[model samples]
Target chain A: MDRKDLKEKLLKIGDLATLPVVAYNVMQLTQNPKASAMDVGKAISQDPALTSKVLKIANSSFYGFPQKISTINNAIVILGFSNIRNIVISAGIIDAYKVEKSSAHFDRTEFWKHSLACGITSKIIASTVGLKNSEEAFIWGILHDIGKIVMDTYIHEEYSQVVQTAKEKGMLIVDAEQTYLGFNHTTVGTLVARKWNMPPALLKVIRYHHNPVLDYNSLRISSIVHLADILCRTLDLGSGGDNEIPIVNEKSWDLMNLDKQTVKTIFAEMEKEYESATAFLH
Target chain B: MNKNKGLHDKSASQDQIDIIEQKYARLKENEPMKILLNAAKEYLTEKGQEKNGS
Candidate 1:
């Protein structure tokens, strides 16, 4: 399909994958400085399933809380509004794209596992790099590969060909996608993220993660997710569609300033936290 | 005969070494991937040692 037609189709698919009403409300409330914890809590409370998930994640060892966080209001105060917002969006997005059928090449379970591992790895990188709010990194990591699923869900036949071509040619999925389809997942994912009204920084990360040096303004954050994606693939935490690893952009790698010791530390923490973070899938 | 057998074993081991080297050549070619693979190797080794110590 042509670029305009492809984007139009992707936008329609984005509409189909809209977040739950409560998730939208929580996002809006968290962004509003005047909105209080109770207001956000009440918004999330409307969806019992999402509230339970938020509470579970807040209490999970991923956060390493000393005491139990029993209620949505408590979770809001303890985990902070941004964290709660991230949890809601994560849960909502995971729910929205329940893969009824996956091709032989794309294991849905492994796909999400890779995504979740990337999220944990991104959070660790953010903290190690002193990026103020690591939770935002977690959400960016989770949503980075969402465009692949958009294609997998809405355009299964073509997506399967892309996956097969990648495997057969031993090419990176992105390259295979470019060769087979006119555009790749990054473009599709950016459109969907735009449709969801995600932050500009996040949109850039989603779009430019494979080639982060393209965007100078969001280069640092994009590079964080970029490195995190590479590390996750190295550990074989999960599959990001293809088995071959892409060459790291030299500029992106230099921006990380990761030493041997720091890499070891990040890997150890990722190993520990990734186990607890899997609670999102359950 | 023993010398010939020794030469054969030496060639087999060299072939095996060559195969292993080829497996990692792509990964080690990239500077960042080389570092990550090395770190991951050490991390796994240390974890294994800890398990044995425990």
Candidate 2:
């Protein structure tokens, strides 16, 4: 199928935009001015998997909680909606990334690991920059490369060649895709976002994440996603051969609100955390 | 961050093991991934039959 036809397919899928029932309820609670801890707990309790996952996370070393969190209501009051949202989104992402019929051009497990790393990194960067709701930044990082999924399914019918070209030219998969198929994953991803009716901010991040150096109004967000993706790739967490390390953009650096030394410090810290996080893999 | 920590308590060591399984599935293992990729291809081509290499 051609790009246009695939675009139609993605629009029809609509699964990504149609938030899980729990997420939808959580989103509503967030909008509720009178939303109490109980209200948040009630919403999460509806989903058993979410309930367990959240409780499991609350007990991790990150929290150092002395007491066991038993019910959704208590967990919500204790953990707050922000952390709940992160767990929900992370759970949703892991499920969404399970590739039943995957293209060889893409590595499903690696894609997930890299995306998770990027999400974590971007949230850290966004917070350091004093951006409100670093959680949103984390979500954006989770989704920035989602376009790759669509591209693999539609354009790269002959997946082996796509992989070879990316390696041979030392090009990112998106670049190789454009050279061979006349369109890239970013543009396709932007189209995918449009179909999802996502917020404009997110659309901009997806479209321009590959080329943060390009002058754009949403330059800061784009730069964070761009930088996060590269750092994950460089660390070789889940990076494919196609992606490359980008030259740090001076403009992006300015927007980061952290100086070179501060960023380096964070990078060192992130490396340790990333190793710990990936240690879960082992 | 501790907010989420309360939630993690529900997961036992086995739960941790399961999560670790998925996590490790995505590591930088060139040889294993290459093997998986090749097997997937062979499965696709042979249409559920024995392939040349297998």
Report how far off residue A183 is in candidate 1 (Å): 0.8
> lDDT, candidate 2, residue A147?
72
- Tens-place lDDT per residue, model 1, A95-122, is 7776446689876777888889998899
lDDT of 2 by residue, A37-103 (tens): 7777777788787677767766665445689888766666677777666666556545544656456
Question: Which candidate achieves the best TM-score against the true structure?
Answer: 1
Candidate 2: segments with Cα more than 4 A from true spot: A1-19, A24-40, A62-66, A99-103, A153-161, A194-200, A213-217, A257-260, A276-282, B1-54
Summing lDDT over every window of 10 consecutive residues in candidate 1 chain B, give the lowest-scoring window: B1-10
lDDT score, candidate 1: 0.79
Fnat, 2 decimals, each candidate:
0.50, 0.00
